[model samples]
Target: MRSFCLLAFVVALLLPTQSFAANRDQHIIVVSVDGLAAYLLNDPKAPLPTIRKLAKAGSVAEGGMKVSNPSVTWPNHSSVITGVRPEKHGVLANGVLVRGAIDVPTVVDPKRDQQDLIRVKTIIDAAHEVGLATAEINWPCMRGSKSLDDSFPDVPEQVIHMTPRLRQELVIDGILADETQPSFAANSVVGKDLIWTEAACHLIRQRKPNLLFVHLLNCDATHHLLGAQTPAGYTANAYADSCVAKMVAATKEAGIFDKTTFIILADHGFTSTPKAICPNVLLRQNELLTVTAGKMSDAKIHVFPEGGIGLVYCTNPATAAADREKFRDLMKDKEGVAEVIFPDRFTELGIPHPREYNQSPDAVLVAKDGYAVAGTPIGEEFVVANTESKTALGSHGFISSLDKMNAPLVLSGNGVRTGETLKSVENIDVAPTIAKLLGIEFPSADGKALNAALSK
Candidate 1:
């Protein structure tokens, strides 16, 4: 009888993670709902049943989750997964700017690939190393990497974007194969979110991946159109909450309710802007930017616009310092510009101190209240009056110091403290916390695990 028991134990250790995950109490699911703000979530009318329930069961960061430098979606999301700043991870902004490259791709650009970007390993890498099945649902950094067993190609091509053509790509993924599904309709951001929820539930049941990373849109998408915390934004938030509940129900139906750990977080918060500043336009006025034959020339100084902040890259190695100082001088007290970050101020924001990437921006230009920075090189004016997008009147990537910039974080499951409120935790801490819970080693992560969230 003893020999038979020993043989069974040895066999169990050799099986795939799914089998072990069933017996062990270490499954973790990370759900990143874009544009989730503490201010909105706490509002009495906001639909936060899933978030509130999770908070009630585990630890909730009362003040909120602080995003990485610039507080943009891609940068902060990458920071959470890699536990490092933009400098180390190489995601300088949502839109990659290579000074001399022929292509500049947006999130949905067909040519976009994360191979040259994403310098470090993510939580998915660590989990995969431990012989676990890992999955990602529209998280950017891992798009191109082979880290996910189930995935959307990390390329911008697989964004499940709102465009009619982009939406076509989703139908091809078979998630929306049923033309009868609401997602098959035109302009359905909500439908896309629903499909992602379905995918999460599907993957959870089918593969039962040890670590599942999910990203839900509605809130960010809606807030970008309606403005932060507005009725429309609230509706989006509520929709996201329902999706979260759906995923949770999937875990329960899978019969692993007692073993799974769930985390709900956002990349950053959103705020309204009165005007938009085009630093490149200003640079052109100062002759620092050169346009020839109706096209932008490869000027020594280039500004990369990232909604609320602009990164100024100086290509001339010899005069990099001088140009950086000049860019600072040009933006100082400028109508819509606030802080011209370089040198000490740059590192002070917890950005990578000595950015090793050749294309790293020489400085950052922060927008003032009621303003944002646009990267348009051909703008007729340096400062354009604000308009609206289909999403929200508010924007993120603003000053991180403001309380409004705070996003929410809720943790629940085995080993997590129940009904506790944490004072603080940054986006960088997320990956490490997941690694700790999953028993994976990730030494490159800069953020510490939230020990306070774990039960003593």
Candidate 2:
């Protein structure tokens, strides 16, 4: 009997530890607040009290989430979901990148076209693979992204894209409705945020998807319209918090509150730009550019502005190498030009090279701290002052490393370590952390799981 007992003990010790496995029953809800600043989370006097509660309950990153290079909307949002950089995911900007030859943003292109460009696995894909139901409520790169639907197959029907173009049908105020006759007009900030929140709340109640991703961009729009501290911005923040409170109530009402984990974060921060610089006009002054009918009809190179950064695409491939060198030389010491990022510098920053894809730019022009890159056509001035007499001018899409550009990262519940503050974390780390919490895998993720923020 003693010999048998000894053998059983040895066999048990060799087996895999059950503690390493994730709590499959635990649910994860990610609420993306589009332009939340890191200082807002750190500030004890900021208007956001609910966010502070969640931060204290679990953990908050003291260093905030450093977003992808350029720190634009879609790219960083894509990174948060893919656990990879912009280069790996193939979404370098919010507007669709013309992968054919233009190598620039096509603002009018369909979201599905944008979706098809994503290359790697996302948390949604991993969740679906493990038989977990997932829903995307206004989250970027999920509507018709091949990475999500190709792996999941049932993703399209599960999304509620509240934007004016892809608005879904909903029953608001207990009445059937669509964007055409929205109970809340889809264009307004309230409409965009509230409609999405209502739709997401409905999904959580009815579908009960194990993973629900909700993006609220009201604060972003408000900040752009009235600046961060205006009454409208505060109103937007309050409504966003109320949305969270609603979801929390729903989880408890459904008896899933204790099993649910809530993660609230933002894509990038907002800052004011003193001027909008048009670099293409400078090329025209040098006679290197030609504009016919207010467009770059006969130009050797085209400049696409992205807030505080601009990408210059060489129109002539034969002279591409020479054009890059010439453009870099011409732009040196130019007003508002911070650093002319050449192709060689791209790889070091994890930007995809032009040789690998048609969408890659030859050189990216970074702006000075108080400047933004203007999408000015041929006739516009080289630099225009940012007039604050009209709409408030808060902006982003700058390099994420800037102190003011750091976005918030608040976490709570599930396996999160209570009252802990991590020193550093990037938006790329979010996907893998979600995957780890769900006991899933995203093999192509560039960021490691945030082990420091999790409880053993």
TM-score of each: 0.84, 0.85
In the range 1-456, model 2's lDDT, one tens digit per residue, is: 999999999987985443345456868888888887777675544567778788889888786878887677778888888898877887777645663343332232334543575777788877776667677777776665433321111123322333322243354443125434334443476766776777667666766667888888788888776666667767777777888888777887777888888899998987777677777778777776676776665567667777778887887777888988888887788787888888888866567988886667878988887788876554446667766212137778777767777888887987888988877788888998888888876777989888888884
List lDDT for all candidates, in order: 0.74, 0.72
Please estimate how well model 1 matches the true structure, expressed as its whole-model Cα lDDT: 0.74
What does the lDDT come to for candidate 2? 0.72
Model 1 agreement with the true structure over 339-426: per-residue lDDT tens digits? 8888567666766543556546678788876677776666567677666211125778876887778888988997799978887788
Give the Cα-based TM-score of candidate 1 against the true structure: 0.84
Error of 2 at 84 (Å): 0.6
